[model samples]
Target: MSDGDPADDIMTATYRALCTHGYADLTMQDIADESSKSKAALHYHYDSKHDLLCAFLEYLYDRFVERTSDPAGADPAAQLRSLVQTVLDKPEDDREAFETAVLEIRAQAPYEPGFRERLTRFDDYLAGEFERLLEAGIDDGVVDPAVDPADTATFLVTMLTGAATERVTAGRSVECTRRMLAEYVESHLLTDATEAQL
Candidate 1:
């Protein structure tokens, strides 16, 4: 664990710097300076900017998993809402960093096998999680039985991505996304019978 600490610290520092500086302006020296670690030390762990970025993505996913798994007692819809809200409500500085990193990695993913794999894994995991939640919602009668789990999951994930993109690019706040999603659930997922019960 002690050995892992520095690497974690480096990843955290790198993420913060990326969020603040964005990908175009980000540099190894910036990471080193922000992290307060020697350039040699940073190099000792990651050989290149790409490697560090890949690690950063991994770190973010790990955090995402932990956050999702920690809370219990809520139904699937509530859990999903919580997940979206968590992402939406992330500290602005951190959100900017994450967006910058993802955009940078996405741009280079075509040429980098490892980065592409990491990106694919992240997307797959998110989609899978949504599928599970949709299934649960169906079982609980909270979601429409006729809704295709895979298709609905894909749609919800797409909506989330669009909302996040808007938040990042158009200066839109998450409240807009939240309102839209709530309306979407009420209109599409919850049946008239269920609506009457609520």
Candidate 2:
């Protein structure tokens, strides 16, 4: 669905409702309450809550791609930092609740093939981005040539996913995780010259 359309409105409402009520407690009525639409209208678009939530997952994936399509930095290190920040940056409203809801959705991925597929796509996308950046950095002599782009990308994605999950599940500090990631970049990814510069 395109922006400003009825379907887009439904997605937006779903996001708000999910953030407020979370996955388990979210209802079509709650989603409709966030939008100008009624519960009947929501049902008209989505036959059931399951269908609506699946659509919402697609919306979130699209938004994530759009958000990170452009990595904003002069160098690979800076670009990597920016990408990670975009993922970890807290929402202005319902910050904790939003993260908790995301975690709840992720927990359901294993049992739900649709959810698992969509979530895997997200990880693959991020890993591919990381791979590109790492390859570029190596070519430019900014990153260690010994670093395997594929393996490093997988490590980075796993680390980032863990950091996001930890923030809500274990009261871990995102700032602390950010610093740790920075350290990983400097100590492992960067070339000797780049590491010395930092």
Candidate 3:
């Protein structure tokens, strides 16, 4: 809205700077240097780093929703597999910085209400996805009837996000985690009826 998407440019620049310097070390000048926007334009759009970072965090979650939504007509169990694989896939060198940046943003959630709001919304995306998948699986007779959709949804998100946290913070082996998740999903989440049928 303000002068030919300068805000977008600034946000893009901010993202680059964020991945490079991380949240703690990133500076306005760094963002400015990365952007085509002038320093004044950057200031006009975001007066402070916290404001910019909150926007950045929101931007990331929004991008995730846009990119990761399961394909239409995919089986619910397959959708669940896709979701698990998406989170559990091993980190590529290029993504390490961005993944680290996401965790850095997550650490701010407890203290910053605005940041917390965006994070909650981001979580809703996963939770909602889990709910839909759980419903579909139940309807299709793939997931166990005894499993409560809401509880399982929470559990799936927790497992996925916990894996993400470990990947960034503790250098967890994603291959190991993915194998464990697949086994757990098969043995626990998926219905015995489906297994017997197979």
Candidate 4:
């Protein structure tokens, strides 16, 4: 069953094919063919399509985390902007597949404890990063002292996620959405005092 440990290659191929063909249309046979592995071999690593999809989500999460590491010595506002820009900059082709994967599993999340837990971890990671940036901004006088860092961070991340989801689902122009989101943060999150300091 273990042949050269080709699971990594198989999963990568599966991800690319799923992104291209979508989850509803994707099949284990298609994945096997794409990965240059036999159907049995594919199943040896992933018992079912559901398992593969879950693994794919984990892969995407890992990639996202790796790509969004905090930049040392960056200003809080700048860090926050970078995070927002990263979310908006997700490739359109991948965006559709990613969104589809999330929506597909969302219903099953309640039944699948692992899925629910992983989702919570991912969400917490995002919120925590945003909160860190907000706290830094407050400390540096780039954000209003009166603003609650936790609330503002959660709001900003939620807003960005909603915008990204719209861009993925509505076929809206990413550039337009990016500009709109940036303008939104600047106008809403940055207070008069912060703007004056900038």
Better of 2 and 3 by TM-score: 2
lDDT of each: 0.72, 0.83, 0.75, 0.69
* Residue-level lDDT tens digits of model 2 in 107-176: 9998988788888999999999999999998998888899999999999899889988888999888888
The C-alpha RMSD of each candidate to the native structure, in angstroms, is 3.5, 2.6, 3.7, 4.3
TM per prediction: 0.82, 0.89, 0.86, 0.78
Tens digit of lDDT per residue, candidate 1, span 70-169?
A: 3343576666566556555664345665675577767778999888888777667777887887788889877788878888777777777777777767
Candidate 3 on 28-121: residue-level lDDT in tens? 8888888887667777888788888888777667667765686343578777877777655543433678678767877888998888999988
Best candidate, TM-score: 2
lDDT of 1 at 111: 91
Q: In candidate 2, residue 194 scores what lDDT? A: 45
Candidate 2, residue 188: Cα displacement in angstroms equals: 0.8
Give me the candidate number with maximum lDDT. 2
lDDT of 4: 0.69
Task: Identify the runs in model 3 with alpha carbons over 4 angstroms from their true place.
Answer: 1-5, 90-94, 192-198
lDDT of 4 by residue, 95-133 (tens): 477566565565567888767777666667788888888
Q: Per model, how many backbone clashes are there?
A: 1, 0, 0, 0
Ranking by lDDT: 2, 3, 1, 4
